[model samples]
Target: MSLHPVVLITGALTGIGRAAALAFAHEQARIVVSGRRAEEGEQLAAELRALGSEAEFVHADVRFEDSVRQLVQRTVARFGRLDVAVNAAGTEGEPGPVTELTPERYAAVFDTNVLGTMLSMKHEMHVMLAQGSGSIVNISSTMGSRGAPNVSLYAASKHAVEGLTKSAAIEGAAAGVRVNAIAPGPVETAMLARLTGNEERKTAFLASVPLKRAGAPEEIADAIVFIASAKAGFITGEILRVNGGKTAS
Candidate 1:
C-alpha cells in the first residue's frame, strides 16, 4: 500500500462520511468522495482539495450494483489503485414498528444499508484482492448488535452489514485484504435528528448513553481512519463500536 493511500468514501456529502473524508485528507490520502448529490459532492471535493489532498467527487447510488461498480472503477481509474474503501453509504429508512413495516419499507432500508454495503464491498474487494493488499471499512451501527424498537428495519440492515463484514474478512484475509465494520452509536448528525425527532426525545435518548451525549462526526471519523490505517493491520472481521458506551452492558 502507498504511504499516502488512495481512499474512497461513499455517502461522503455529509455527516460521518464527510468527516472521514476530511480526516483522510489531513493524512494526505488521495480521496474519492461519492454521494448522490452532484452539487454537494463537488463542493465536498473542492473542500478536500483545498485541504491539500488530491480529491474527486463521484456520483453514485450504492443501492444499485452498476453505480457502485462504476464508482470503484472510476476511483481506480483516477488513482491507479484503491488502498482503502469506506462503505459509508446507508439509510436509516423510515423508523417504524415492525408491525407497521411493508415489503417496500424493508427493501428501502436493505437496499442502501445492507445491499449497498454488500455491493460496495463486492466491487472494492475485486480491486483490493487483485492488488493483494487493501482495507475496507463498512459503517454499521449499535443496532447491528442489538435490537431497538421503532427502528427494526434499520437495525436489521446493519446486522446484515456486520455479517457481511465478517464473512468478507475471512475470505479476504488469505488474499491480503481486510474487512471490518464500525458500529457507531448515536452520533450528532442529521440522521440522529431524524431518529430522535425532537429535542426532548433526543435528550431522553441521549440519557441512555453512558457518555450522556451524542458523539461528534469527527470522533467517528477518527476511528474510521484508524481502522483503515496500517495501525489496524492485524484487525479484521471486527465490529468497532463507538456509541458513547451505549452498548456496554
Candidate 2:
C-alpha cells in the first residue's frame, strides 16, 4: 500500500460505513464515500477533507451494476488507483419469520445485501486484479453463521455475503488481491434499533452477547481499518468476527 492509499467505501452515509470513512481518513488515506444520499455523502467527504485526507463523494446505489461500475470507475479516475474497498452497503430489511417471507421481502433484502455485494465485488475486483493488488473488506453479521428467528432474511443475506467473500478471495488471491469480511454482532446503529424494535427487545438481544452490551460503530470501524490494512496482509478468505463474544461458544 502507498503511504496514503486510495480507499472507496459504499453505503458510507451512516453507521459502520460512516465510521470506517472517518477511521481511514485519520490514517490519511484518500477516500471516496458512496451512497444514495447525495447531501449526506458530500458532507462526509467534506468532513474527511477537513481531517486532511483527500476525499470525494460519489452517488451509487449498489443494487445496480451500472451504478457500481461507475462508482469504481470514478474512484480510479480521481485517485489513479483503488487500494481498498469497503462494501458496507446493506439493510436489515423487513425482519420477520420464514413463514412471513414474501418474494418482495426476499428481494428487498437479498438485492441490497447479497446482489449489491456481488456487484460491488465484481467491479472492485476488475480494477484490483488488473492492478495486481488491493484489499476488499465486506460487512457481514454474526447472524451469518448462526440461525436467528425473526431476522431470517437478514441472516440469509449475510450468509450469502460470506460465501461471496470467500469465493472472491480465492479468485483474487493468486492475483495478489485480498478479499475478506468483518462479521459484526449487535452494533449501536440505527439498523439495530429497527431490528430489535424496543428497549426491552434490545436488552434481551444484548444479553445474548457475552459482553452483555452492544458494540459501538467505531469499534467495528477500527477492526475494518486493521483488516483492510497491510497489517492483515496474510489474511484472506476469512471472516473476522467482531461480535462482542456473541459466537464465543
Candidate 3:
C-alpha cells in the first residue's frame, strides 16, 4: 500500500464507521466515507480533510447493487484505486423473538446486514482482484456466533456476515486481497443504547462481559485499522473478536 492508502467505508455517518474514518485519517490515509445521509457524510469528509487526509463523501445505500456499484466506482474514479474497504453498514432491526418475526421484519434486518455486506464484498472484490492487492474488513457481532433471545434476526444476519467474510477471504486470498471480520461485543454506541433500552437493562448486559464495561468506538476503530493494515497481512478468513472477553467461555 501507498503512504496514503485510499480507504472506503460504508455506514460512515455515525458510530464505529465514523470512528474508523477518523482513525484512518490519523494514519494520514486518503478516505471516502459513504452513507445514505448526505449532510452528515459531507461533514465527516470535511473533518477528515481538516485532519490533513484527502477525503470525500459518497452517498450509497448498501442494500442496492446499483448504489454500491456506484460507490465503489466513484471511489476508484476519485482516488485511482481502493486499498481498503470497511463494511460497517448494518442494523439491529426491531429486536424480537423468533415467534414474533415477520417477513417484513426479517427483510428489514437482512437487507442491510446480510445483503448489504454481500454486495459490498462483491463489488469491492471485483476492483481488488483486478488491482491484485487490497484488504476488506467486515463488521460482525458477538451474537454472530452465539444464540440470543429476542435478537434472533440480528444474530442470524451477523452469522451470515461471518460466513460471507470467511468465504470471501478464501476466494480473495489467492488474488492478493484479504477479507476478515471484527465481531464486536457490547460497544457504547447509539445502537447499543437502543438495544439495551434502559439503564437497568444496559447495566445487566455489561455485567455479562468479563470487563464489566462496554467498549469504546475508538477501541474498535484501532482494531479495524490494524487488521486492515500490513501489520495483519498474514491474517485472513478470521473473525477478530473485540467484545471484552464476552465470548471467553
**C-alpha positional error of residue 203 in candidate 2 after TM-score superposition, expressed in Å:** 1.3
For candidate 2, which ten residues in a row score worst on lDDT? 92-101
TM-score for candidate 3: 0.99
Error of 2 at 14 (Å): 0.7
Clash-forming residue pairs, model 3? none
164 Cα displacement, candidate 3 (Å)? 0.4
The better-scoring model by lDDT among 2 and 3 is 3
Query: What's the ranking of the predictions by lDDT, best on top?
Result: 3, 2, 1
* Candidate 3 CA-lDDT value: 0.97
TM-scores for candidates 1 onward, in order: 0.99, 0.99, 0.99
Q: Pick the candidate with the highest lDDT.
A: 3
Give the runs in model 3 whose Cα sits over 4 Å from its true position: none
lDDT of candidate 2 over 1-249, digit per residue (tens)? 899999999999999999999999999999999999999989999999999999999999999999999999999999999999999999989977889889999999999999999999999999999999999999999988988888889998999999999999999999999999999999999999988889999999899999999999999999999999999999999999999899999
TM match of model 1 to true structure? 0.99
Residue 211 accuracy (lDDT) in model 1:
91
